[model samples]
Target chain A: MSNEVEETNSLKLVTPGHASSETEGRSVDAGPGDADCSPDGRVPYMMSQIQETLQTLDTAVDTILGKVEELHSKYEREGLAENPVLDACREITFACCFHDLCSQRLNIVLKSLEEFGDELTDGSNGTREEASILASVGESETRSATQDVQGGGSLLNGPAMTGEGLSQEDVDELLKSFEEFN
Target chain B: MAVDKNMPVLIVDDYSSMLRIIRNLLFELGFKNITEATDGREALKKLNRDAYGLIISDWNMEPMSGYDLLVAVRKDEQMKKTPFIMVTAESKVENVVAAREAGVDNYIIKPFNGATLKQKMKRVIGDF
Candidate 1:
């Protein structure tokens, strides 16, 4: 819709279908909007209007940049960088809003994995394991999206989780060791 | 009596990561047979399709919450005697009592350890 509006404005500056043809070096008799064309073939009024539209586009770009900056700052202030739930919720919201921007959603998914570090920082000591586990799982999509490593290197791959080599006793011992460390 | 390792365990939670973690933790505890559902409806479907010896569920989930799942399980002739445990982030004493009244064999609050999970499972399913 906005593209149609912009194209219409550009068309008003020249003959509608001839606009591209004119740019490609094909000359046509000046239309009503091109009356300011000089005898030598330069259209001063049309050139100035094009320049003005370019300036407007430049300003619009600047405004979008400013809005992105403002959003980033607000996100920082909200502590979304440190909260898994907030990060995941924001990622989903972004995906919904910018449905066409697959790269944006993918990046958000990867960045949200930092919640794993947040979990480690908060640590599991004396916290309700079920809640912590739930929170961790909620953020797991992010971690999975960013997983470049293979061979069971994920957080799931504890020492006892030796890429399917260890026995159940080894897993228990690993859990015990992790518990002791925590 | 010992838990039947061959019997499938049904883990119900709204979060996928928690399900994976729980499944892995159960695997570590020597229970290799496990299945998961994201909510009560899926859980009920899975329960109908398979015979699960034990169920671990989260209280807050859509379309047949853990509480609803427990009630449904108890009402089902085949699953009536199966052990049910509620794992939830809601830590209120009243909530625990309500779960107990709903026929939950055990309950665990969130942020629990693998040891706590194992102990709870042992209490419900008998020693491994």
Candidate 2:
């Protein structure tokens, strides 16, 4: 609802859609209440009325600026300024989401495989293995979200895994040793 | 006994990254028929719907915990014998003893790599 400050700046509610388009803030002709706008575009100092109008306008501008600043702050945090840290954070978040997507895709494929194999019916053997592996030693449950890469046991501590291939002599010596054993 | 690459395995965890990490490690170890779940309750639902050869689960979860799930599965006649491995960060001695007593086939401490995972799998389900 637009608060129609009438010819005289006493704030009053206009009957919403019923207010005439032109009577929104000004009348076709000057009336006793509109002595400040005597058919000229110039604004007159209507003392108390002018002060109240200025205060309202100031308040409205502040509200709008507050909203704009909030939006700007949000954009800044989201890397609208091309901040490297924010960009990295966003990439990490996206990578995590990608991880979930891939995991879900794997689950979907497994589900379809199960339905297709239908181990009880004919051709079930395609997915089935010997029953020995399925035997329980014990039973449980759980998922979620990874970060800490603590080597909690001796397993991760034994070696610094390298992607680089071994030296030619190392490979030759290793193959020769295997050949001798064979 | 030789482990079948196609043997259906169920892995449960709530974290997607951890889930992906475990799945990738399993894939590297040649296990293709893998299923995933976010928690014990969901895992149990899947367990009832189908059969899985092995279960790798985490200890901490909501609604139903891995420990509780282990107890429930051990109590259930149909699922009591299924191999279970606890892959989690819960490394306290008491927790390990409790899991052993509950019949857990193996326990894997967190931050493990493919080699670590493979060793645990070998201990629990034989060589793949």
Candidate 3:
């Protein structure tokens, strides 16, 4: 079966030349039967490739970690407790009801909005106005909820906006309530 | 006749930021006595403890929504017929219809200007 070839090829280990030198004490090609088949050199060869790949990955991971640390330092230097995205999420339950201002500082939020907008347009693009409107709608809801909780009122009472019709009686009741508020 | 200035207005929402925003907005608009609740259940608790002239609520929430709050407010003997408005992001026609059926006094869309809010308030207050 081709699977056997794949398995064998997959298992062929290639060690880095440096690694091979470091581990020269270990006779990697000690199998006597391998003498007939180029000393089964495939194993060490593949191992080297894998080790190189791993090194690359490790270096990349370290670079990313360093970048994150640098970003953290930047936030601290600017006197921000955290990055804007984290700040905005935390504010969802505590402060900064108007997420629009916060989102301005958060690249992640902008990226997410861009992605969402792309998906909404089905890749057709050119819907900046639509995306902006939706973003505002989201921001308004966030603000309302924040304001309601801060006012010691239930979360249900914040001012929300949407394009919807109002009936006369409904208006009457609100008007009546406003009466008492006045 | 002006509504008693001392009468309280209860505003509820799930987000603290919005709670502060609306409270400040209301205060700037001359609403001096205000209370807050984070959800419908909490609003009900506050309602049971005191009287309010107006209730402004959001429609969607966790642990009891504004719709639930409106129904409860209408059902309570002392709170029934108290003025209530449904301020919500659910701008669907069906949602508004439901709010109207449930007895919302007025509806205003989001991202509203202070003038619009004041206009709505004047309409509700009748004296403004």
Candidate 4:
């Protein structure tokens, strides 16, 4: 009976409890009362973080754009009409347009985050419904953008190529294919 | 009529960066007379103010898209015959078909370099 009591006590020591040394090192599964249960509070925090990151990106783009414009003006004033230099300037200017593209895409994300934050802070049953609706809207937008990139469904709905843009050879081949079809 | 490189050309896009890029490309192609508008509505207002020899426009814009602009241009008696090229990131066949049906002279996909732009312009307005 004493051995049985000792075994029971040992088992109790291993069981999860505030005072159990054994339980200290083991991670307990989170329950409804845990700090992680209400993640709604973190939504605004995450949104703010994203907003800050986007602002940084915007500032970087603006600085690059400003520098390019200044270089373009300098080139013009210097009467540097060298073809290669002019061509490089043009290419750099074209590349700078990526900031606009990024801004457009980021706007979509920011809008979605704002909607989600609003839903989270509402603290009503409608929060779930709103979240669901927002999620679906986001999903649909993503799917549509994907479809546009993939050239899925109608051939006329999206970009000609996915990431990295189309090569000159690819463009030529596409033109040929179109001509062949026509 | 053969394209006159100095003839006034109108470029339209909602993104100013895109407008600047297109203008630069046109400039590189030896097109000296170029005008820019931020969107289709602005393009229309400019269209009424001046006669453009050619119109190159981005398809996606708020309020009035390039398609709407094209339709409006086609409907107008004065601008009906102007060479119009629809530039868009979208390469969907449906959009191509619709633009074709709507009487677009040519289509150019985005991220196109000067060489590609030159070729497309040559096709639309004849070799510059």
Best-matching candidate per lDDT:
4
Q: How do the residues B1-128 of candidate 3 rate in per-residue lDDT, one tens digit apiece?
A: 87666679999976554565566567645688999998898999999999899898866666788877887887788998888876654444445545665667777644344555566666676653
Model 2: residues with Cα > 4 Å off, grouped in runs: A1-182
lDDT of 1 by residue, B1-128 (tens): 76678889999986554565576567646788899899888999999998889999987665556777887888899989989987765444345445555677877655455667888788778888
Model 3 spans > 4 angstroms off: A1-182
Q: Write the per-residue lDDT of candidate 4 for residues A94-115, one digit (tens) a residue.
A: 6775665566566666777777
Tell me the spans in candidate 1 whose CA falls farther than 4 Å from its real position.
A1-182
What fraction of the reference interface contacts is present in each model, in order?
Answer: 0.00, 0.04, 0.14, 0.35
Report the TM-score for the A-chain of model 4.
0.48
Clashes of each: 11, 17, 52, 10
Cα lDDT of model 1 by residue, A2-68, tens digit:
1111222244334433343323442433433444333222333334444445455445544543454
TM-score of chain B of 4: 0.95
Q: What lDDT does candidate 1 reach at residue A108?
A: 36
> What range of 10 consecutive residues in model 4 chain A has the weakest lDDT sum?
A1-10
Q: Give model 4 RMSD, 1 decimal.
A: 11.7
Per-residue lDDT of candidate 2, residues B1-128 (tens digit): 68788989999987656666676557646787999999899999999989889999987666667777787788889999999988665555445556666778777655455555677688678876
lDDT of 4: 0.68
Q: Scored by CA lDDT, what does every candidate get?
A: 0.57, 0.56, 0.56, 0.68
